[model samples]
Target chain A: MTDKKMDIIRALKRAGNNPISGEELGGILGISRTMVWKYMKALGEEGYVIRSSPGSGHVLVSAPDKLYPSEIMDGLDTSIIGGDIRYFDEVDSTNDVAKKMGSSSDEGTVVIAEMQDSGRGRKGGHWMSPRGGVWMSVILKPNVVPAYAPRFTLMAGVAVAKAIRGLGVEASLKWPNDVLIGDKKVCGILTEMDAECDQINFVIIGIGINVNVLIEELSEDLRSSSTSLSEIKGEELDRIAFVQALLRALEDEYIRSKTSGFDSILEEWRSLSSTIGRDVDVVTPQRIIRGKAVGITENGTLLVETAEGLEEIVAGSCIHG
Target chain B: MTDKKMDIIRALKRAGNNPISGEELGGILGISRTMVWKYMKALGEEGYVIRSSPGSGHVLVSAPDKLYPSEIMDGLDTSIIGGDIRYFDEVDSTNDVAKKMGSSSDEGTVVIAEMQDSGRGRKGGHWMSPRGGVWMSVILKPNVVPAYAPRFTLMAGVAVAKAIRGLGVEASLKWPNDVLIGDKKVCGILTEMDAECDQINFVIIGIGINVNVLIEELSEDLRSSSTSLSEIKGEELDRIAFVQALLRALEDEYIRSKTSGFDSILEEWRSLSSTIGRDVDVVTPQRIIRGKAVGITENGTLLVETAEGLEEIVAGSCIHG
Candidate 1:
């Protein structure tokens, strides 16, 4: 059903300013002219503006600002990632939905929502996910143990950081899970998974990017620490293009993780690290380790040089000291 | 409702052979004599055999083999681990139910079912969980990264091995997550969790042990590799007592993990390990490492000494060579 709709969209997009008649579309798709008109009406209902004239036929105008599956298909590249994209107008969380689909869905399946009613952050924190933000989760079935999860987290951080940096703005990665623009966070990555001790069943890499969202949408307590792309750029940016680049970058890093042992991705993360080489306080559950971030271990753990010498922190919340 | 039932059960058990009057039970519970009679009737409905006489009161005869939450509480010794025990006659999987209860239920909440229609094993294998088997999941909210999950897996393994050895049969642990009796399998521990990259929200340790179940209950393919406690001991052991001991052992190991850096648990695992000092083929996601198992790393990773020298295998399925 959507193949024909995609054909019509592609045909219209290829024609540029020139109008393509329903008769031409029917001939191209081997369908009747009435079916072509029906597809056009469906596209119109989806907020795709179409201009129809008597002699010139129909001209494609503009598309909605929503992240519809068909709309994401416009500029989306990659073979598997986002290939089976599921879009929702609203959801409790994309990660929750992705976890449900984990057992059945193929690797790289994507779940996205325009607004999340109860989006989650790291450490049981809440993530504000109003409209105009990129609230999505990518399903990955990596063949590794739970201990190797840090590589995936670093892979996502690098991918999100690269996508944000592609917009000509300097975006750095905070160790473990946050993407920051200077001192404030513009994006966050929450990677959740279901795994046995030695093997992962599936991993849902939830990437929440505040694209074209108002800064006021965040809770008052987090307003100072969070910023959006529109707030930084002083204008709304095209979300469709940004999401395409982000998925592509993520796919690149994911391929690298499997192909090159994630060493390149780890190096990229090191180069863009906002935590390393800085005075920081890592608050682990067992104890607080205050030191200068010295380096990253081979397993993606943070090595900090404390008064007791170098200590490796496996998991913690980091605050700039 | 359950408190009253438990109080009545305790009263009957405390009486032992002496029949306590309904009047005496009511006085202890601060309820009417009629309420005490009703409680006895309820216990009778739950497969509890009771004997009533004219002058004397009700005498508890025998309790059913069912792992009711009330039954578990009788011999349970753990302060936190089994504080909230959930029991079902049947379920898809105890792990599935435990994951749902993990968010709201307190740490160490235990979920058990007599039969699982879809019991899951490690690496997407199926576990036959018919009646007369111990199918359960323990919810653990550990303050550690997913990398440290191996410790919990090892902890559950040592606890399970201890419980099985308590049955007068030697049970040893395999690297990663399997329990064995001699050369065949007796128990398996599957550790699953929901976590962000840096921290774990919850870990569900699913343990499946065959007690009174028959050896023929397993699929034909698994029959040669699997055995039951009843088959080994030539008698059906008391499950309620076994589960109490298992939960107590698990709670002890869990407390030790927090007090110690899991070095002690690792040592216990090493002592009970059937994989250590054995020539083995470790099948990992990336490649296979064939070597003699030398020792365990401090992080519970298997150290294999191959021809290339000592190798640290973080995650793998070990097969004895």
Candidate 2:
């Protein structure tokens, strides 16, 4: 299915000023003319404005009023992000796609899905992602080792929180990787990275945002804990704009991580985090540590103060006070 | 391919006292009679001896001499190592398979391959694995968070070294995750784990051992830095016995990790480590720290004493003195 769409997109690009007949598209795609038309319609619905005239041919007129590949390629601000977009109608998980692509593809490749069939939260929990939510994963190649990958989660959280705030809705970062409104989770970010002993190959940042999804659309169990931008702002957001803003913010943080240092980024994370200074229970495989969250260290470890003393947490799930 | 093999094994076990004819096997396998014969031949080559009588059909005479699934099921000691074995004639990587299975499969499941098309080393480097090497990934469902994941890498290194030593080969631990023979890497362990804010799902320990690989077969540049058991011992070794020993050692360490404190394991690691008391360069993403390798912390961080002072190295590649 994806292969056919790529063919149509490539065929349309080749046709440029001239029109491509359905017969030629079919021949190129090795499909029937009817199947070609069906694919064209699918592309059109995805915002590809290919003008079709019966018998005459089809001309690439304009793309939809969306940040389609053509639009993203036209003038994407950063060097990465939407530089290479893989749009999927439905996928099990964008992270899975990004992880598969991590070895072969260039860094900064992005995978976007309209909906995720197996959207996941942290700790193998199901992430409630209905239609109209933004489900995407961005692939990044960083020189950092796996130990510092937690910072990518923190960086992504800060970016998502800032991007949500740009929509005029109050959003804050919950420690590790959640963008929340007051106490409800508005967005979640999962960072998956592959590393060698000393260096990292690529990291996939899977971000899910409840953009235009209504509170009523959420499952009853999650309704109280989950909120959407539209529900909070009383208006639907431009998802393309939101994605672009997020990519831009993410690019800035990624650049800092690569070129300058994480000191400023850590400072930003500290300022935006709601997890620090809270009473929390951190459950590791060894034992549960209940403590007051003190701070996040330079290496991206969570520092906790227990009755015994200060302990650094590298990995664990946290329960908020 | 694996699913069909398991079914065939199950069917043969169920029809114990009777010889299953080719026609019957074909009927049960939903494959052609020719395919049934081919699968049986493949199974026989893998160490399952079938007594075939032209008129009476085929009967399982005795188990073959290999550590194939059937034999592994015959009272394998470990809880997780042999529980779920994913055997592959050839794969890009067992770690890749384990990562795919890591999300859904139970802990202790193992993925083993006869050959890896794209085997890898730590830090995104290539791992030279020929057909005779023990290229496998063990899925561990430890309650520990992702930070403690490095400990698994450390434990695997210790296990591999111990298993190699059991074969009468001189082995030494090289800090983080390498088993060495006189400073040349004989085996490498890559540990990948997934975690949420405070909980871990599973850790995949991808181990690559040059069990029977000849040093002459190694890539030209790697020849000096890499050694194989075959080359070191001047003969081929029993891979099944080595795998069993490694798994047993791993089980002991893993059990101790759960029951007792990590003090004993850390002590064993310190004794086996060749890096301790040596001057080395630890290269991380941010900077390089040159110092004397002191000891390993319980969390698996490398403690180094630099000219400035003592420093803890969490994740990095080490260049030993």
Candidate 3:
């Protein structure tokens, strides 16, 4: 839908049972009275309840609760990140779509899906993406080497954790790219990049959050290990607002990473990390290492103090003891 | 274009000036005499000089000196490297084509072009790829993190140097990915990779070698800094034999790197290196580091002992002081 329809709906909602004149809307939106009426009519056709009178131009009764581009972009304050978003009712995977578009897409382009038929996790794992999850991917073009690419996963984790904590929830960061609510995973991030030797062409960051999914919606295996925001708060969240907050936080962190450095994001990640200081088992493709998760390196490698010594683990699945 | 045709041609060339009977040729190739006659007719149509007599079947007078897939694959000893090659008469860049195919291609899939319209060098420079040059790219699916990708460039350099040295030329390796003769570059390599988080999906190693380009054909600026095999050896080398040797050496080094480790390759690289022990200027995107090139790290980073201290540079352009 057009932003004008959204603006008209928002204006009528703000009026709160009072009638708003078309002239006032035209003045507010810098459009003609006829254009305002056209927008109101469009909004009414889109299931928005509106009433009109001779003197009172329009009044809003209710609006749809769907996550439309206009709804998500209503108050998005970032200059990038979500500036150009493609919304899909259903998709195989947002990451796949974003990856296909990444080479030619502008930096900060985004793709979001209402539901995914083939959502994926790290190492070719399947992710259960129900209707209530926020499945989105963003494209970024960073001027960095492939070695420094893993740090973007940490940056995304920190951004997601900060945004979730902003809603008064105790969200913690997991090693690599996960957000946890208490001991259960609430979000997962997958970062992929295309690079030519030392220079990166583009990176696609896929973020999937269980915003309002019910516990029963998860598969039997994941039911006990996964928690949604609605399950933690005992109520469904405003998904549009949550997504806006997340995009803003991610954009801010991305800017910080590009302009300043990743140190601040790394510090924030360390503060929210749930893996540090815990005895853990990290299973890499080659072998498994048991150790205390001591710290993280600048390149986003996990520093584990094992019997062998301090080992830097680049990739693995971690199990806490 | 077919292996059968190539087999007939190879057999006839091996006979020198003698003509073998069609029955014997068919028996040697496990085909009927009519099939051998058809292949001879097709080869003659493709500018190959073949003569047939009633008693003495067919004889090859001369064949075009082209780097066709059949020619390169004829008696190729590598188990991998050149097993599945996609040959192009002309292409924009072999690296670009290989990168596009990398995700779906097999581990040792290769792309080669007779001439590149827009061949590229490292750091956004143009590579002059004439018809006689070897412009090729190989796709590798290594089980390693993206941080270890630079070592493949070193491995490729070693392979190319060893192959050229086998041809009786004193070929040396430059830091990162250049094969040089004396102070001039005779070959350049560009490595690219796709990765997700901590795991690498695929790597494209693009190798461009100046095999038989004439010295006078080079641009005025490049003439002083570039030299070809024909220029150094005073004759046009056999393009098919050179590619076979290069692919074999590359496959050997790749297997060694995977099965044993990169230490042996590193030792060979160090011995062939023209940058080691030289006072060098390493120009990274961020800054320029001036130091004595003491050694190369296992990850293919240049170990530069600067005035400040020792520094490991992951990616950059190197210049000897």
Candidate 4:
């Protein structure tokens, strides 16, 4: 759909269940009245409930809940980060799609799928992304070195946790990149980058959230360690609203990270961190490091106080003591 | 070509211009005499100067000067670095091909081109890859993190410098990733990595060397700063032999780095470095750091002593002061 139609939808949404005259929409969109009527008719055909009366002009009652390109683009508030979103009903993984698209697509382009057939987590583990889960990847072209790429993952974790917390659940961060609710995993973030000699071409941030997935649908082993938003909130949350909130939060954090330093984001992340100050066993390929998670370095490395001394881990799997 | 054909060619090369009987070749290769004769006839048709005597069998007098897959693999000594090589007569860039092939290609696979129409350097600069230049990229699936990827460029610089110095040229290392003779650059290395989170999928080490390129062929601006081997030595060097030495050095350094650590490579790099102990200005996107190069960190970062104090630079373009 064109941006003009989206602007018209936004104007009607801003009116809030009240009718907006075709002349007003045309004036707002800088188009003719005939063009505005044509866009309204097209939107009506695409499952948007628009009411028109002799006295009242046009009211946008509701929009489709399905994550369609037009539906998601209708009310997006960001200037970037989701300006161009590709929606898929099923995919192998949104990250894979984003990686393929990253070479040609503009920065801040998004790829989202309802279900992933072969979703992946950190360290090559499988992530079960069933229906009702938020499986999405965002392409970011940040002007930074590869050494600083890990900090983007931390920023994303903060954004996701903040969005979840905004829904009245106590969401927290796990070391490296994971979001949890009361010791149960609710979101997993996998960040990937394509870089050459210190210069980064693009970074793909893949976020998988168990929004409304049922407990029985999860794998037997993961059922005990994972929880969904509906399970904690005692009701099914609107996926569209949740995704909008998440994207807004992500855009805010991403802009702040690029403009200001990561000091504020790091502070917020540390406060929401569930791993810091906890005794944990960080498993690397070389050896298992048993230490207390003292703090995080400026580069996003976890500073662990091992028996030998202080050790900074760039990548690892953490198991709490 | 098939590995079998390459193996037969290797056996012929091992004979060193001496004729080996067809029966002897068959016995050595565990193949029939007819098969040996067929392979010899095929190699002769492919620009190989093979002499066949009725009783003495076949002898390899010379091979093509072009960087063919068979010619490169004929007598390669490295165990993994060049076990698989893809050769192209002309390409946009070897790095482009290597990045595409890195996903499925095994570690140590190489992609080489005789001429590159659009070779690249660091910071999106164009590299002059005319004929007689060694334009190649190696695909390495090293078990390392993305932060450690820059060290591979330093290691490649060391390897290329060692290979050039072995030929009696005064080759030395530059800051970050460049090889120089005196004050002019002779080789440029671009290292790229595909990574997600903390795990690295693969790294492509693209090395470009101006072996026999004429100085007049370079662009007007690069002519003053860039020097080729032929320009310095006043004679063209053997391109095939130089590539062989480079691969050997790279394979050795790569193996040692994986087994021991980057400490040894760091030591060797520091010793050959022209930037260390010299006053230089490191230009990053954020700011310029002017200081005396003091040392290098284990992660291959340049340690500079500025007026403020000692500073570690992760990625930058160094200019001699």
User: Who wins the DockQ comparison?
Assistant: 4
Give the CAPRI rating of model 2.
acceptable
Off by over 4 Å in 1: A1-62, A273-298, A302-321, B1-64, B273-294, B303-321
lDDT of 2 at B142: 84
Which ranges in model 3 have alpha carbons more than 4 Å from their true place? A1-75, A87-92, A212-218, A230-238, A277-279, A285-294, A303-312, B1-65, B215-219, B286-292, B304-312
Docking class of 3: acceptable
**Cα distance off (Å), candidate 3, residue A254:** 1.2
Selected candidate, larger DockQ, 1 vs 4: 4
- What DockQ do the predictions score, one after another? 0.50, 0.29, 0.48, 0.51
Residue-by-residue lDDT tens digits, candidate 3, B123-165: 6689989888999999999978777788889999999999999
- Candidate 1 vs 3: which has more lDDT: 3
Between candidates 1 and 2, the TM-score winner: 1
TM-score of each: 0.82, 0.78, 0.82, 0.81
Scored against the native two-chain complex, candidate 2 gets a DockQ of: 0.29
Per-residue CA lDDT of model 4 for A193-283, tens digit only, reads 8897577889999999999889789999999999999999988888888888999999999989878878988988999999999999999
What is the lDDT, from 0 to 100, of the residue B216 in candidate 2? 80
Kindly list the per-residue Cα lDDT of model 2 for residues A230-296, writing each as its tens digit.
8888887777778888888889888887787888888988888888998999987778999999899
lDDT, candidates in the order shown: 0.87, 0.81, 0.88, 0.88
Q: Which residue pairs in candidate 3 collide?
A: none
TM-score of chain B of 1: 0.95
For model 1, the DockQ equals 0.50
lDDT of 2 by residue, B1-321 (tens): 365665677677778868888888888889888988889888887777777888777777766434465545544578756777777778999998887778789777888877788897776678878777889999888876455777888788878888999988889999788889998999999887654434456678999999988788778998999988988888888676777788888888888878887788888889999999899999877899999999999878899999999999987889998
